[model samples]
Target: MLRKLPLLVGAAFLLTAGPAFAHVGAGPVDTFSHGFMHPLSGIDHVLAMVAVGLFAVNLGGAAIWLVPSAFVGTMMFGGALGYYGWPLPMVEAAIGASVVVMSLAIAFGVRLPTIAAMALVGLFALFHGHAHGTEGMGLGVSFLPYAAGFVGATALLHIAGIALGLGLDRLGNMPATILKRCAGTAGAIAGVSILAGWLAT
Candidate 1:
């Protein structure tokens, strides 16, 4: 449908842009701007974050917000742990796995009670947060502003995902369902690729 044009275009842009900036590292995060750009720089993070939004939308009802909220809140806790130099084993692997789980859920149209959904996303958020925290530790920047920037950017990515989900829902039929599934499949492939890269490195 004509309505899907912009969303498709945006998705295209992100897909193309992601690899060029992928996980460049936290070395540049010496300011709020740098912190904000950190997540955007990584394809893995973007995929997982957007998948969270899609998963929330698929669940419908309060899950639309609750799931993302849980992720954000718990992610902050994980970030704090990272900032304090706490050891969280397998953080990178966990993050990659989150992408696989979330995207597969969307692809299969998996539904759960709001509480369960929140817990699922929250669990993944911890790994994501820890990554940010660990990377940000020695940046010598003001923690509050840096945190705020990254959090704000994350929220924006979620909103973009939700917006796409909502647009598909508006189509109100098999087309929407197919598109959602396609999105999920693409996400799944991305997850697998990230995990593979991690293994190689």
Candidate 2:
């Protein structure tokens, strides 16, 4: 019973995750504030970012940090492309797919080589960053501060996921693994809902 609290919270998050789409607002306003709030505003961003952390923990070893770092670093480059009006194919759909793919990774406890895991998350970060970058384009905003804000926010979300994974790990292997996999399963379902247009993320 005690160990199940986190699972309940995770379930609540997923259930309530519907309805918040990416880039929700009237228009780009404050640079730092908007960037900071942007990732928090969208379900897709939150899910994918957190899933990255969870996936990292699943991989264990150096992957615990390297995977998330690769994502942030690559996302910045992707963000730059979007900010400058460079087009990437299937940006939105790719964002949705990132959630599905990453969540499935967590659900199945998939482990790849550290480099392979880093490359995988890096690929998804490009689309996520592109979305962030494109959001502020044409708004005459300061790219550095805005980018910093989102980067900071993304890192925090990743940390939250890391904390969740680490906390569950203390609860004995079998229970913890079951709960983590359950989270991944729930997240995958939510990702599917977003892709299907039922959740509108």
Candidate 3:
């Protein structure tokens, strides 16, 4: 549990600070940098991306890679919709909901079939990608690099979650399970806090 303190603290910080969609209009800058920074700028993105990784580790097996892949791939497709100005209703709300659902899944040690897990994360990724896409609105040619930047950042965050999850799991089954649940419960509370913040705003 001590080993996981930093990550838990960071997640808590995400819950307490930053805008829901801080990436919506990143200023003029290198497209890649802009995109890369977007995910880091918001609490919602960090929580959801990291939670996907935790969920993957909880599922175990091929799901470790497949689930994250599903999210990234589907997220890109959703980004395209946003880039093209296709409307996705309730994107912010959906993103918040994703955090709540995914974190709770981890908290409870819920294990769905690999395909179902993939689909669940993939569905969440759409809204995430759309948020990224819509942010790059007029970037035109720069959108690709911006998209790449965010994708790269998302992948890194997922890996971090996986590493932390795996590390906790190594502490012995019961201890690991307890720690993961504690982390997930914190994440779920944070997610709810974020949603309430959004509603208040």
Candidate 4:
């Protein structure tokens, strides 16, 4: 398990990238059960979800939970906003931008005040949650189970990010510089992809 850790983490992008965009919003779902599965249908959601965990590992301490917590809490808020038709402008673009920006955070190891970081991430989660709600709406997907699946899967991804991050700490005392570069590059690419998606959509 230890030796293969790197390969496993590295493969996240490859596995996630495939058929990731295959489903942005819930295309179809007869039962409420499908709502729970919608988040996994897209790569952007998967990567964004995982990035939260990877970043938490980097931040450590209360952050491990705080960050993800903020995401969950705020996501619910976003969902509520959507449910009520709050009228947020440029919602799709915002969602894509969140993915791009957050990816850059990990890629560059951008140092931000903890409070600021949480707020930034939480804001992004709102867009995420809103999308989830909108996509799964009236799809027969159980709200509870759907939220659970989305949150649970996202948490699992975060754990993977933490594990990989810990592995990096042990492997070679890898330079922060290097990690930032990789993260930044990945983020840039994600951002571009998201931008393309927005344009196409």
Query: Model 3: per-residue lDDT, tens digit, 1-201?
Result: 323433542453445434455445646534788778767777777888898998899889999999999999999999989988999866766677677778878887888889988988898899889877887777688668878998999998889888888998889999999988898898787777776574321
What TM-score fits each model?
0.83, 0.85, 0.85, 0.75
Clashes of 2: 0
- Candidates by lDDT, descending order: 2, 3, 1, 4
- The alpha-carbon deviation from the true structure for residue 147 of candidate 2, after best TM-score superposition, in angstroms, is 1.6
- Tens-place lDDT per residue, model 2, 179-198, is 98899898888877876667
After best superposition, candidate 2 residue 193: deviation in angstroms? 0.7
For model 2, state the Cα shift of residue 119 in Å. Answer: 0.5
Clashing pairs in 3: none
lDDT of prediction 3: 0.79
Q: What is candidate 2's CA lDDT for residue 196?
A: 62
> Local error of candidate 3 at 198, Å?
6.7
Candidate 2 ranges with C-alpha deviation above 4 Å = 1-26, 139-141
lDDT of 4 by residue, 1-201 (tens): 224323423342333332223323545433434655566666666667667766776677778778877887898888767655565645555566666666666775665556766887787788777766665555443455666666666666667766766666665546754775586577657655765653222
lDDT of 4 at 45: 69
- How well does candidate 2 match the true structure in TM-score terms? 0.85
